[model samples]
Target: MPPITNVERVYQERYAEAHAYLKATNSENPFMVIRAENKFIELLEEPHIPFWMRAQCNAILAGLTDETADARKYLKGAHTSLGYFVQIRELATGSLSDTAGHRLAQLREQLTKIERDIAAREAAKEQRSAQNLEDDKEMLLEGQRSAQDLEDAKQMLLGPEQEMLHEPVVTDDTRALPKTEPKPASAEQSLEQGTERMDIDSDRSTATLFPPHTEVTADSSQHAADSDTDMTSQFSDNESTATVKMEEDDDEVL
Candidate 1:
């Protein structure tokens, strides 16, 4: 049996109340021993018992602290203290069952593990956030560099184009390239040159290939006819002279 708490004194003081509560209930038919035993056990289960025990222990401890006593009072105080210790132990270990303690221990372990897991996850998330920030910084730098390069390229291109547009087309150096020249020949010029060449060729064509042209001479033809007439007259005169000589010779022969 557990040692008596200070409630033992209270129950001793109110023994009549316990007896009256027993008489009022069905517990009256039973022997007072059994009835009192059951009622006392029920009283142990009451909310007031723990507070009452604590107050009694504090009172005893206070009295012991105030008094410097010889051997008998000291022994009595020790006995009361021992009894109070036993009652507290019974309230703590006896009322709080083994199963309840086990359950509480499991809950404590689970709560601790959950807290540790949450902490680790938060740390990892913070690390990832830092890495993401670094990556974003690099990306921003790369974007700025690309934008700068593109701007420089655009400026260089526009400068050259402006210079080319304002520059002169012709140069004093013969080695310098000429600008876009005329691609087509004019039709009137081609036709005039062609007609001039055709006229010159016609004027000199067959005459130049053979001899020079000459005038026909009518006087030469008349002179040749007169010479033929003179030849005919001389032949007639010779024939007449020959006839006359033949006659003279005939007379001499006679």
Candidate 2:
């Protein structure tokens, strides 16, 4: 076989690099995967690279990027490349290598799996969002009902008290009347009656203590006057005798 040309050598180097980058997708480091995707994108820009290799590289890049739309595009390109490869192989005398066929099959399977996973994730996200909305609605309704019930309870508890406060009060107007003229007159009459009864009682008591009185005649008045003079002369004689005895007692003491 003739020595490989410079173009063939460059294509081999780029193709190996792209495959190496694709393998890094399984690495734990996200930076490694990102770097690998960038290298694969560079491979796509090379003119010497075959269309089938470009398709596989794009599928690997899309998988590393983890984007649904990019994965779908890569899947489409991969299918087209696969169909062309099959047609070319049937017409050619020698078929493509088993390794190349295996790589194409692997690329197709990976793209299909990516599409299915994206669909499942989107469906799950939608279901979670719907469930959260239902829960929020139920919570809001329950809060409104609780607030309404509390308001109703407050009204029920305070209704009678409010009515009692607002009710009209009944009172006896007569009890609040001012003093009248007839009341003073009645009070003065009672005082006068009490004074008259007291005076009459005193007079009756004095009469009971004194002797009874008889009619006065002219001769009886003269005899009573002479008796009064004799009584007065006897009182004077007794007083003179008391004075004479008091003097005799004083002389004896001296």
Candidate 3:
């Protein structure tokens, strides 16, 4: 005899229990049948069960159930299982039954819609990312421009200040020269003194050059006396004028 596999052993045990439950005809023991159905459903969930078989089991469960909600739930699970099994089988065998082919076409339509939605979302995301990058680039350029403007402004502001700092400064020590005290005799005073000296010398020379004849000597002496008096008066007038001018200067200064 062939060695009994784990799957076969499990199936045998489950079949025995289910057959026993079905064979019991006690009208008061409906719970036993329900328990058997639940057990069968548990077997369907096992990975060892073929997906197609599980789908068939779920469909039978849906038909046997009286509750509309439970029936729909079972049917939906059956449809999902059937779709998975058909996709896997078609990949391996490259062929499908009519029912599986129709189900696959419906799944393909759903897949196409999902793929389109995903592509649209990705495209929108990429567009947003590109827009954000462009915005960042613009912001960076703006910042650079602003920084450059600030630097230019700083240079403009500093230019005149630097020129002023470099320019030569004229302080009292640099500009002032040592002064000499002025002599008291101005050109006018010196000129008057020189004229007076010349006149006196000429008169003395004239007096020495010729002693006048005795009769004219008395008249010459009288004329010389009158000239001497005029000279004294002129000297006095010049002194008064100089004094007045000095007073005027002093008043202006005050």
Name the lDDT value of residue 241 in candidate 3.
100
Per-residue CA lDDT of model 1 for 1-254, tens digit only, reads 78877866675555455446445534222222233333444454455655664454345334433231232244345446745765686687776568855665564554455345445655866998999999999999999999999999999989989999999775668656667887676999889989999998987785676547643479867887899989999999999999999999999999
Worst 10-residue lDDT window, candidate 3: 25-34
Q: Runs in model 2 with CA error above 4 Å?
A: 1-23, 26-103, 170-254
lDDT by residue for model 3 over 92-211, one digit each (tens)? 999988986886788656545534544565586699899999999999999999999999999999999999999878676745666788879989999999999999999989878765
Q: Model 1 scores what on Cα lDDT?
A: 0.60
- Give me the candidate number with maximum lDDT: 2
Poorest 10 consecutive residues by lDDT, candidate 2: 26-35
Candidate 1 Cα misplacement greater than 4 A, ranges: 1-100, 160-254
Q: What C-alpha lDDT does candidate 3 achieve relative to the native structure? A: 0.70
TM-score: which candidate is best? Answer: 2
lDDT (tens digit, per residue) of candidate 2 on 79-102: 678778777885794766788778
Error of 2 at 62 (Å): 19
Better of 2 and 3 by lDDT: 2
lDDT (C-alpha, whole model) for all candidates: 0.60, 0.72, 0.70
Which pairs of residues collide in model 2?
A: none
Pairs that collide, model 3: none
